[model samples]
Structure formats: structure tokens, C-alpha cells
Target: MSSGQGGGQSGGQAGGQGGPGWQADGRRGAQYPGARRRPRYRALSPLREHLREAFWFAPLLTCVGAVLLAGLTDLLDREIFAEASAAQTADTLLSFSSAAKSVVSTVSSAMLTFIGVVFSISLVSLQMAASQFSPRVLRLYVRSRLIKATFATCLATFVYTLLVQLGYDDTSDPARAVSVPIVSTIVALAMVMLSLALFVLYVQATMRLLRVPHVIDRVTRESLQVLQDYRWLAPELGPTPGAVPEGPTLLHEGRGGVLRDVNIRWLIRVARRHDAVLYQVPRIGDFIAPGTPTVVVVGGSAPRPRRITTALNVGVDRTMHQDLSFGFRQLVDIAIRALSPAINDPTTAVQAVDRIHQLLAVLAPVHLGELRHRDKDGAVRLVQPVPGWEATVDLAFTEVRICGAGQPQVTRRLAAALDDLLRITPERRRAPLLLQRALLERAVAESVRDEDNRAFALTPDRQGIG
Candidate 1:
């Protein structure tokens, strides 16, 4: 995680460096004990990212659009109603004027109640879900386009109907609306129909969101999208590790946060401009305090510290953007939470494991490479470090395996996850899964007392039970 200022801010890549870099291994010689600042990235504001993921954003936009649409349709009605040829159609609409007013009033009032009651209940349910699953899932939940569309349509219909209702003529007759808005009334009715349809869809979506398996699937899909975005060199295809170039070092100079984003191309351009190699000391996702060495300028003039730090973005939480491992962290959190003593929900943990397995299987064949970024001439202009396969695998399986020790359901599902990965994953990438399998076997044997339960736990069952 680099600097996360906001808009379009990405998560850390699995093994790719997001611009800024640092060594966890103390290989950078002497360290600056007291730090100064963890500078922020230039592009992608935090507000923009929040708006992108925020549930209110779409509805707010739709409400504004509805206002403009109501006004536009009012003008359109005047144009159509003025023509002598339209007299017949206008008279026909006037006949049902009372019904139109009733319909508009009904929709405007009903939509308000529907939004209030449903959303109030939804917020409460979502809070409960955050506790049962991971709080992070809440962020993902609002990201559903259907959820946004549903809220947007409901609000828009309310606003449009209310405006249409106001234009109805009540002075001419108490029994009926004499000056009925022709096109506007039709538009309002159409909006009402759309809102009703969306309500049904929204209810179904909300119900699915409450289920653990669906949430896991959503998270997994986001992670896979991140994984699919990387065009970097794979591990086998990457260059050999070279010593950090000796040069002027730029230290972080802002408030510390998780390294969340970086413009790698920007880093390369800066390095290329100075004819120096830019070596990022802090990997994306590393929390850096002030005085922490970030970018090392090698073999050329030192680029301004602000210039180097600008390439990195920092944020309070990990995103699914460029960070491949962040997804794994989330899935693991859900698994660990489910396996906690108080919850002891083995089935939920199994669902989380299923996603973990899915992500690992996708990663197995990928050849993750070095964090080296090169210029047009093929010379490496920037170099950042990424976690290797072993570290990533450990992050995904170790914690869940440890927490799931005594639970037969969790252990068996984990075994199945490992075994499934072993079968599909390339031979070279199978080591970590094998190691995890052995550890799972050892843990289950040591924790579960009854021979029958132990035997059941040791067997690989994708379902965790018959």
C-alpha cells in the first residue's frame, strides 16, 4: 500500500510494486530511527474514492437528474398540448385527470415510506452482517451497481412524482384535475413502474447480500478482477535480484498510513528524467512513519523527495485495486472471525475457504516477477520489492488453518481446498499447498480427540460433510 489520497486509488499488487518501496529485511544498511512524514500521492483523492464506493453518490445524482427531467417534461407537455391536432388526445387525458393526480400522489408518498422503512431495516441488517462477517464487506456491499440503481430509481421516482403532483390543477374542480399534465403524467407513471420493479430486485439482492456465501463470492470476484489487471512480469520471468543502487535516499514526510497506491509509470518517468535508477524502499501496503527511507536515487541526480513520494498513495484501509493480497487478507479475516471461539461458525469459515481456494488456484499458474520497471530503452529505471509465493501462500492459509484446528468442518473443508489446489496448480507452485496440507493434518490430529471425528476431519471433502 503506497499513498492513498483518493480517486481511482488502487490496492497493492500481489507481487508488483506500486511505485514507492522499502525493505523489511534491513538490507538497506543503516536506518533512520526517528521518522518525519509519509507523503501523499498526487492523483486520486480520498473523497473521490469514497464517492465511487459510497451508496449515497448514485441516489444524489439521480435526484438532481430527476429535478431537471421534471422541468423538461413540463415544457414538452406545453408544446404537445398547444396543437389543434392534439386536442383529441388532450381531452382523453383530461377525462382521466383525477386518476393521474391520485396515481402521482400515491407514488410520491409511498416511495418515501418504502425507502425509509426498507433502508432503515437494511442498515440494521448490514450492521449485523458486518459483525457476523467482516466489516470490510459493508464497503463491498454498497459497491453493487444494482443496489445503487435501485436506490437511484426509487428516489428519482419520488422526486419526479412529487413535482408532477404539484403541477396538477386543483382550483378548477375539487372532484377532478381540469388542467392535467399530459406527457409529464405519463413520465411520472413510467417512473412509478420502474421503481416498483427495482424494489423487487433490490429486495432479492439485499437478501442475497445477507448470506455469507454470496458475500464471499462478491469479494472473490473483486480480487479476481484485481488479479486480472496485472500485466507485470511473473515470478519465473522476472530478472534476478540485484543490490539496491547506492545514491541519495528520499525519506517519507507525511502522516503514516497504509501504502495503498502508486503510479509506477510516474516513478519511471522521474527516474528516466534524472538518468538515475529509482529504487522504492517501501512496498505498497507497508505503513511508513516519517523519516522512513522510501525512494533511493542511484547513478544520477537526486529527484526531489516530494516528486518521489508523490508517486505513492496512502490510505487507512487496503483496497482491491492493485493489491492482490488484500483480497486474501479479507477472506482470511472472515474465516478467522467465523472460527473464533464465541462464533464457532464452521460453515461460514468454509465459505471463506472456498473463495481463498478460488483465488489461489487463479494465482497458481501466474508467473509473478520482480518489481523492476524499465524505460523505453529496456533499462531498469525503477525497482520495488514484492512478496514471493511462499509469503503470499502463508498469508492465505496459515491463520485459518491455526484457528480451524479442532473444528472438523473447517479442517475438512481446508483439506479439500488444499487438495483441489494441488491437483490444478502447476507442479512448481504446489509446494506451499503441500506444506499447508501437512500442517492441517498435524493440527487436526493434535486437536481433535475422538478417532471418528479425527478420521472425518482428515479426509478431503469440498462440502466438509456428506
Candidate 2:
């Protein structure tokens, strides 16, 4: 009995020793035999990331440009309009009296009114999108260059016209009337016209936001660009697989939200400098709460917590920068919302499914998983978690499939989408596609009557016409 107890104690010690090497969430360790540790560093500048996501960044820039342009025009007025010959020419050219005050004032007032109208239209569109689609759609609007440009131009025009109006005072002295900067006034009038043109463009853009196809297409385009930007191919040597040395686990302390992006190159550099391997806990789109373990260090002393926090850009919502699944989530949200009883718009759901199929097809050929970053010396230093093809596929379709149950059009389109994925996906990845097809088939069986099942069970009809 004593020997048996001793054996149990030995097993317990073995288990204890092994515990730190493995993650509770079942992720593989960073160290693997026959794998060289090559650290890679690819960090997006925080300032650039902030600028890209900042709603005011573009507008502020436009305002600065307008100010500089105003200064240039003022200089032109001083240099050319102050000359006697230029003044004589100005007399022959367009010259506005103090009466033109009303014209400049009118333009400025119209610009202000136009700005309000543009904002009102945008806010209304955003509210509708948030309710009908998803609150996440608002990010698309915020990041839209067109929207920003429109706002900037309108605001810039208002400020310019107001400044120009201030400079125009015919009543002060008749001699100074010739130096009224007629050219600046004409430019302000042109700006007023431009603002009117932008108002029309803004209306068109807002209308596009209400269309499901347009929204889905926009998300797909953005996500594809992100995929291209990251060049998410598998590492040539693959991940090192073995037990990692136990080190510190860095818990996040910042305001909790979605894990949007990580400065991978920076993390790789830090890991290499410290002779450690850092494992990111949450995938890009995963929500991280304050105090959650975010990065696990192995093999050496951990870097400062602030360094890790700064390397990661957490936000209230996900973006396409590094989060591939966000686009899928947005598309799926629209699909399921369409299938909801209140909406009951199966056609829209089918449209979303088609786009999902396209995105999945693009992702099928790429490598997806924990991305390993290698340092200059070809040693792996950073291990960041990313959704594999299977996870992405699941995310793309699972919820929509469940929510779309009983909708013949949505189910048929889903079946077609799975079939397309299977056709394009390599044989090695066919298992997941097949499994999804089976799940979808089962769902169809339960939700649809046997008569309808016969049709859905056959080769999927893209139009649900089978």
C-alpha cells in the first residue's frame, strides 16, 4: 500500500511539472524540436493606426489645408492687389461693394446649414444601419474617406468664407474697396458650389449604406485588403511544437474591448531581446476583459506589461486591420438579422451568404492559425493566435446556419456556398467543409419538411430553384 501511494505521488509530481508547459485553453507550446526560432517584427505605428480609425483625422487635415490655402490667398491679395496697376485691373474686374457682404454671408450661412444637413443625414443613416444591420457598420461610415472629405470641404468652406467676409469692408474707405480680394471672393463662391455638389454625393453614399449588397461588398473588399496587407501565409518552417518554459503571464489592465490589432513586429523584437517566446491569449476579434491573461511569456524574463499593452490596440469594436473574422461577423450579422422574424428578408440573407462564400473561397487557400514571428537571426520569438481556416469557416456560417433554419432560400444558398467551398478548397481541408455540409443538411432536415428536404438534399441550387 505504501508503494502504491508512492507511485501516486510520483504521478502527481509529474502532472505538476507538466502543468506550466501547457496552456489551459489547449494551445500548443511555443517550443518545438527541429524548429529554429526566427523572430519577426511587423508593427503598425500607433499614430498611424489611431489616424486611420480616428473619425476626425481626415477632417482636421482638411481644415489645416484650408487654413494654409487661406493664408496663401491673403498673401496674394497683399502682393498683387496692393499694386496700383493691379488695383486698376481689379476695378475693371469683378469688385463687390459692402453690399457683397450679404453674398459672402449668405454663402457662409449656407455652408453652415449644409454641414448641419449632411450630419443630420449621416446620423439618420447610421441610426438606421445600427438598428437594421449592426452597430459595427458605423465603423465603415467613420472610416469612409468620402464622408470625411465632404465634411472637411463644407467646414473648410464655411471657415474660409467667414474669414473672407471679415476681410471685406467697403464701408471703411472707398480707396480700399479696390483691394477687396475679389479673387478670394470668387474662390469662396466656387467653394459654395463645391459644397452643394458634395451634398449630392453624400446623399448618394448614404443611400448605398442602406443596400445590403453594397455593404457586404464593401466589407469583403476591406477584409481582402487586410488579408493582402498581412500576407497571411503559413510560416515556411511552421510552428515549433513542444513544452515551453514557464514564465510570467501578463494580464491586461486596460479598458476591455475587442482585441483589434497587435504590433507583431514589436512583440517579436521584445521577445527576441529578452530571449523569450510570447504567446498571445486572445485572437484578434476576441473580447478581452480587464485583468484577463493576455500574453504568456516563456523561456526568459517577461517584458514590461506596458510594452505588451502598447503593442496591442484594443477597441470597443473590431476592425479589418488584423481581424479577418470581423468581416465575416458583420456579414453573418446581416444574414441572421435578415432571417429574423421582424425582418424576414430571406433574399438579403442569401445575398450575404453569397458574399461569405466568396470570402471563404479566398481564405481557403491561405494558411490560418497561430502566426509565428521570426527574428533577424531566424529564431522564432512571438507566437500570436489567429483563426485557422476551420475557425473562420465556422464563424462565417455557423450562426447564420442556425438562425437561418426554416428559411428555404437561406438554407439553399448556404448549401450552395458549402459546395463552392468544397470545390475550391484542397482535399486536406475538405473535411471541415464536408462537416459543415453535414451540419447544414441536418439543420435542413429538422427545419424543413421531408418534401422540401428532398430538394435541398440534392445538388444545391444557387437560386433555391431546385
TM-scores vs. true structure, each candidate: 0.80, 0.81
lDDT for each residue of candidate 2 in 1-466, tens digit (9 for 90 to 100): 0111110001111121112221111112323232222222244565776776676877788778777776777667656656734446645433444445668788888888888888888788888888888787788777677787788889999888878766664544435553556567677778878877887888898899888789889988987766653342232224334433467899887878888788766677788778888888777878888888888898878888878887887876677777767888888988888888988888888888888888887777654445555554445567766666677878888998899878777777888888888887878788888988889888877777787564654447687544
Shift in Å, residue 421, candidate 2 = 2.4
Encode model 1's per-residue lDDT on 222-296: one tens digit a residue.
887666544222222444455676878899877678887777768878888999988778766788877889988
- lDDT of model 1 at position 144: 69
Candidate 1 lDDT for residue 264: 71
lDDT of 2 at 237: 26
Candidate 1, residue 273: lDDT: 92
What is the TM-score of candidate 1? Answer: 0.80
State candidate 2's TM-score: 0.81
